[model samples]
Target chain A: MNSTPNEQVPLADNSIIDLQEVSIFYSGKIAVDKVSFPIAKNKITSIIGPSGCGKSTLLRSLNRMNDFIPGVTVDGMVTYGGQNLHGSEVDPVEVRRCIGMVFQKPNPFPKSIYKNVAWGPGINGYKDSMDELVEQSLRQAALWEEVKDRLHESALSLSGGQQQRLCIARALAMAPDVLLMDEPCSALDPISTAHIEDLLFELKSRYTIVIVTHNMQQAARISDHTAFLETGKLIEFGVTDQIFTRPQNQRTEEYVTGRFG
Target chain B: MTTDTYQAVQASNINKRSTRWAEFLIQSGLGLCALVSIITTIAIIIILGKEGFSFFQHVSPAEFFLGTRWVPLLEPQSFGVLPLVWGTLLVTFGAAVIAIPIGLASAIYLSEYASDRVRSIVKPILELLAGIPTVVYGFFALTFITPLLKGIFPDIQVFNALSGAIVVGIMVLPMIATLSDNALSAVPQTLRQGAYALGATSYEVTTQVVVPAGLSGVMASFLLAISRAIGETMAVTLAAGATPNISLTFFESIQTMTAYIVQISLGDAPAGGIAYQTLFVVAGLLFVITLILNVLSQKILMRYQEVYD
Candidate 1:
């Protein structure tokens, strides 16, 4: 019974996965309503909106993190490469293996830095070169150079920025096809945010990126495409520059101009 | 206002405030009470230490520690401590064996697995167990547990270490669980969340992260429970027999240090006699043992600490 996602957005090619009229209900309360969108493959697609707009909910649904919460029911079909992700035959754990997530706050286990990166690969039964894989994952997350000397230290002993990068390394160790970032830099200072932005830019050439950001400026800065949502509804989706500078929808323009949230 | 004017006004306010002696008197009263407790403690130590030193004069320390035979009430009155000491240790260790696993698991269940609704209901019931009288537990052990064990092990003695240890175990189960549960729950939720995010299941998170993080406090609480079991008198006196022997068999009846005290007290020993002095000696031993354990636990807590940011 809530407002719907924006309708005039260009759908992702059939080459990528698509959502059709996806609705999420948590304990009889609507979280995301009839939201339909295609997550572009191999591009930095940023979901930019104010807080409590179901942006994180939509991101979590992509990886089925919502499954952890009780009393959450979904009504819609999410097809990844034409395979029904929500179907009974598909395990949510497998879906998560394919689609990795990085949360707003960095959560590193109370383990060594090496173990933190090695966890995902070990769980997935990567039988060889676990040390190399840990190093490689840290390198991929652009954290290896700083942490290579202290791989035995607890991951939590790192600075906030370092810990966030370690979390990215942990997720990257999973080697997922797609990465979902929920407000990755919302908790970071500018220099750290810049480091992550540069890392994401480097990553997008190989991995599909879907980032949720409260910072509209961050959306305009690093993203290729931007989708604006408000009050559990998508208001606009377009090229990042167009969404920020010359928005087609009135609500998008208002949000972009800081006139309304 | 200028800086000088501000200081003047603040100074006036401070001077205007009441200089009542009532606050000082109340504070001094509390300080006096604390001092009383300290002095009473010192007095107890002096009294016990004097008698314990007297025991050293009658019997060498080596004989007390190493000698096996304990015939303190016999004609020669052998004052060897090995039997009583072994009996005390056996009962304490046996009690710990019963207490550690069951108590730790209950703590984990209460802190981690149980919901608020379950906790609110279960904790009060567990607390009720703690309120049960030790003598009642002694009676239950003698009547109920002894028969149960005898049914299983047909050759087992009616009043045995097994019975006493089991009863003492049940008696302190509530304290162990409650203290350990508090310690475990005191570990921050962030650590747990971090563990879960690493793909650790709930069980792994509990055993690996939560328990290790709270180990020091848990150890302190464990030591405290051990001391409680050692200090327990009535239960072991009734359930475990008065026969003091340095034996390892669970089938034989054994007496504990506290039990020996009770046994001696029940006899008619005139004041100022060596027997009367012996009472202080036993109590002094018990007090020192508990104090050392408490201090050791505190030291352990200080050493192996877990700090969360």
Candidate 2:
């Protein structure tokens, strides 16, 4: 089943999700061309590329997030633990439950902080203590301490960074096995970005994390595995340290070394 | 070279002066345009107050408010506004019952489900409903809707509150649907994506996230549409049959406040007479009811306004 020509494809002990030669097209135009990479279980994988180079487009395909866009077409296969995500038998709603996403901007629902976390689990028919679930998810996203007292307050009242964390908590409440982030920290300040980076480092121990990031250093700082993409193609995929320090593809080296986008 | 610089500066100053003059002129013109509505409102208040206050002298406030009968021309005329108030309320309530579900469904369909092509084709047709004359709607209620109701309930009158209300509801449906659609569309796309990412089905997202986010706007639209229905004149007047009978039955002919004013004013009620005074008094009363509704709705809207940025 392994058809990629690259010999340096790093295989992990437990790969929870895999994109096998997946290409995405929006309205007959190719956004990501034949990009395949394995997202190892319980590890942070960061996809880095210049803007409009299809990093986000590729990341969105994992949970069938691109299905929301009209005229979007996905080629090849995205699989979660050997189950095809795009197969007719798989419901996108169920797929999204297993593989949740956090977007570029912090889009907390215009609701109370409590509702923001509880809504996901509540809608998905969580029969246990909703309050406990909400608090646990918030704590997991590193937001409970700051937001515990004002749980009923509007989520919009929180700061930009806090809102981003709340969004993460909202995603976590669904108890997803894998979390896909589309430049989640791109809209935050440097301090907020660092907090999220640290949170991601801690989160990888439990949930498989794949993030598309524009910041090269942030990717290097937090990600265990890094996938560098250029012009809709996967330039290189390897351990973060190796990709940053050594040379494989000239483009990946150039992109990581501050030489070229 | 210095003279050339001086000439350029002088020319620039002249251009600046003209620009300032143009700006001042345009600013004042815009200000005056805004003031037109304010001035008109003031004038209406003055006119209605003068005549409305005169009516109070002829009839005591307690009698006008508490009394249920509203006959101005008869010898034993009673001018209690309760019957008119009940009539207005009944028609408005009936209209709301018919309008809210249909309007919101159309709004949701237009906003969440419709493609660009479908939206383009459907939106103008809805707007066309708004453009149809209220008089035409009145005739529609009288000629078409009343007969249809007569079929359902054999006891229904030729001119009845139900028919008037149903037609008014149809008349205001465009407003509710259009404004509600705008409100729903105003909800950001990212929020919908965020909900979808949380494994919510399209139905859940529409009902929970997108709808709640745009709730204030939808509520505001509903309030505005209700106000329009309350203030509706011609349709209610023609279909409801201006008998001023204060019955609770929907099939019974009743007279709304607007209909009362029209009936009295058109019948050549002498100027400054008790009958003529009823017109201003009822108009003033109608004005107060709608103003309170608008104010309360605005306050609620402001309180729940969800700023997504």
Candidate 3:
């Protein structure tokens, strides 16, 4: 059921990030009202909502990606490792270093496949073998075997599915503690979406993941926890099975049953 | 079929026929406009070839191309075109040295760092530099920049390659900045976001991702500006003296291919003589050089576009 705006959702002890009464505004217009939730460590958490429901806005705030937007203001707190992410002392660049992201569309740099994977660690002064890192990251994203022979080829030469996986590999190269995905499979075909969904499931074992998806079935299939949102407010937060099978709120049930968005 | 339906179909067909006719007429009109430019270019090439062939008949191709000394007007006329080519290249290179780094840096600032408000206010002022007449820039070079250089070198000549180079750089700077800014700005926002999401700082994102992604555009702008500098006449004619000497230092006077063309076209050279025919030959060479640069720029642009698209 929907909790009070100021009340914190009870989270597991293994929670890695906690949002407390977070509200986001763009040009003084509220996009996400006061909402509180916890993202568990090494678990996949899916945020499900219809279009314009602040899912992406909330996800972007997790890694301070929202800082790039003009006139964007985040009230309340997003905490990671006991530090407020929005604290004046916390640098957004460093915040992104710890928590990486994948966008809705595949956005690979116009570089070779190897460089695309190595760029993150290289810029961060990885101080290790770049070749090894690129291989390991690609292997983790399940793209190494397909692109191993052509590591020096342009990343643009890859197919859409391969490009999206390359984006995942690029993010994985940073070796961040968490990965945020904003509808990472929205532009993909069903086969590619399934491929990415499987990749996310494997990635969750190593990195905590927060995904915003419009696909209810995807949330039910892979996520350990699911949060249903409507009109900038969290409608329900519970285990994925229970939310889909026996949603406590009427709107959640209606959305889950495909009766209405 | 119903009679009303048949009539409606006939009426629709008539409308489509009229629309097709109008579309054909408009398309042909546009085609004619395009053909006019193509025909003009061909005509220019034919005329240049005819005059250049006549000029080459008197002066051998090897002498014109390989000779180092170019004295066409005086009695002991030895026409080696290298000096003019060297002068043109020297000024173009100097202008490039001044403009490329400064122009690219400003483009990066405008595209990546500047806010929309700041960009709008600054870009127009930068482009205003391009609008000033080249004649005015020539005088500005003669009166302003030469004096400034003299203050530095003290022994610098009144009319020297340095002054011409500086003015030409200023003249072409706005082209590089505006075109490079457009190219940099055209880089998809998603690519920038991708780099930022990878924990790149703004500087790293600009240099590593955005700049590299937009490099073809920047290179194209550089080539175009270089070509423009090569073709510039009035500014170089006034600032760089008519001596036609090939020297390494910018402190000495020199004459570019464009300056020679201007000199001959000023009603001094007798018609139907070798001195006058040299004008067409030099102009032909300048045209070929610019054409090569333009073609190379377009090739780079097309190659990069394929990668991005």
Candidate 4:
């Protein structure tokens, strides 16, 4: 199992992910229309858009999340590690195991905090030193400090913000290659938002991260690269500072300024 | 002068109206129906106590508790409740064994697997099973179910606990299924979303999240179903024979407590006869059993309640 973090650059540079002419449709209604892009290895990609945009849909498609819904079909290619994701003989369960997702709302199981983090790793059968791994994952997510003493407490007892971070920690325990987060901090308060944003900054070095955010400031502050989407279409993609300071598309400009959130 | 006289007649008159406090008293009076309920309960207890005491005067309490022979009309007239109690337990256990799996599976399918149109169609049909007259259920048990069983098992007695248990299972299935469905459906959608987001298959989520969280509700429904089975009389009387055999075999004829009460009531015993008095004692026993179960169910539900949606 030869694995490299920087394998998604390009053919010359060995890009880890390649998307070509990919479109997502839900019963003839296009959710992501003809979007093609390459995600660099170990770099954070933030998708910013108003509500109803297909940022999350695009992120979910990358991992075959849309396969669960009936009448959802993807027309195009999504290459991960030089393999087509939607190809036959490809199990979505395997794909999910590799590319895990965290949702907008916190969804901690009605389980103990330690058990919550141990769940994915245990199911995937990561043998040896499980007790240590759970601790390490929680520490990495910055949840261990506050919840370290109460690892046996029900995950529901935590504040809303803590639960979301616990969710992040749980995903990390799965040991996925890419982490897809759909508005992870939109439901948290300001302090908790800053904490999660900082955690994201810390996480990008180890994992390829794709986050969908509604907060322009969050995108500007935390993202290395930002893609703006509108009504299931990619409007623009560029460096975060460049997208905020200068814009090529009117829709992108209108959205970033809080004109029509 | 005539007009002034008419004005004087109309003077110093105020329409009578009920005060707000009087209205409050009227509402409070309606609310005190709780008192009426308490009084009815006390009256029932008093009546049962008197009748049960009179039964003990004729039949010793030790004999009632331990004696196996239950010949109420024979020359010696040995009055023991153990046979009736054992019979009640046999049928109730049989009903529960049939009800639990089928009822829970139906609930799971309805809440988790079925589509809305199917649910809408299936729910009322299930409720219709509950709404069928107990007497009709009795007749169905006797005329249809018993003969059907006899076809399958050639030696099954025409009147046995199996047929009555099956009918009662169907009758109480709706209660358990509907209650459990409500509980399972009440589990927050977020918990499910969380499981899915964690890359869990739908089967995993259903087993891991939905089932455990809904367990308390399912247990409560089970207890309630047991209570209903204990209180059932007509179907058991018709389908299960009046032999008062303390047997566990479903293929053989048996007598439940309810059936014995019905049997006693249908026949004329002297005003203070031991058999006549046993009905109250049996009723007391049934009341105690149901009360304990209800309390246990409430305790589990209240103690481990998942408060947040």
The candidate scoring highest on DockQ is 2
Candidate 1 chain A: worst 10 consecutive residues by lDDT? A1-10
Q: Of the candidates shown, which would achieve the greatest TM-score relative to the real structure?
A: 3
Per-candidate TM vs. native? 0.86, 0.94, 0.95, 0.87
Instruction: Please give the lDDT score at residue A128 for candidate 1.
Output: 88
**Cα deviation of B225, candidate 1, in Å:** 2.9
Ranking by DockQ: 2, 3, 4, 1
CA lDDT, every model vs. true structure: 0.82, 0.89, 0.91, 0.83
Candidate 1 Cα outliers beyond 4 Å, as residue runs: A1-11, A14-17, A67-73, A77-91, B1-18, B267-270, B299-306
Candidate DockQ scores, in order: 0.26, 0.87, 0.80, 0.39
lDDT of 3 at A251: 94
Alpha carbon lDDT of residue A135, candidate 1?
A: 85
Which candidate, 3 or 4, would have the higher lDDT against the true structure?
Answer: 3
- Model 2 lDDT tens row, A50-99: 88999988988899988878999999898887788988898999999999
Candidate 3 positional error at B53, Å: 0.5
Let me know the DockQ for model 4.
Answer: 0.39
Q: Give the per-residue lDDT of model 3 (tens digit) for B159-199.
A: 89999999999899889999999999999999999999999
Q: Report residue A61 deviation for candidate 1 (angstroms).
A: 3.4
Q: Where in model 4 is the C-alpha error above 4 Å?
A: A1-15, A18-22, A25-27, A67-75, A82-89, B1-42, B56-62, B303-305
User: Model 3 clash tally?
Assistant: 0
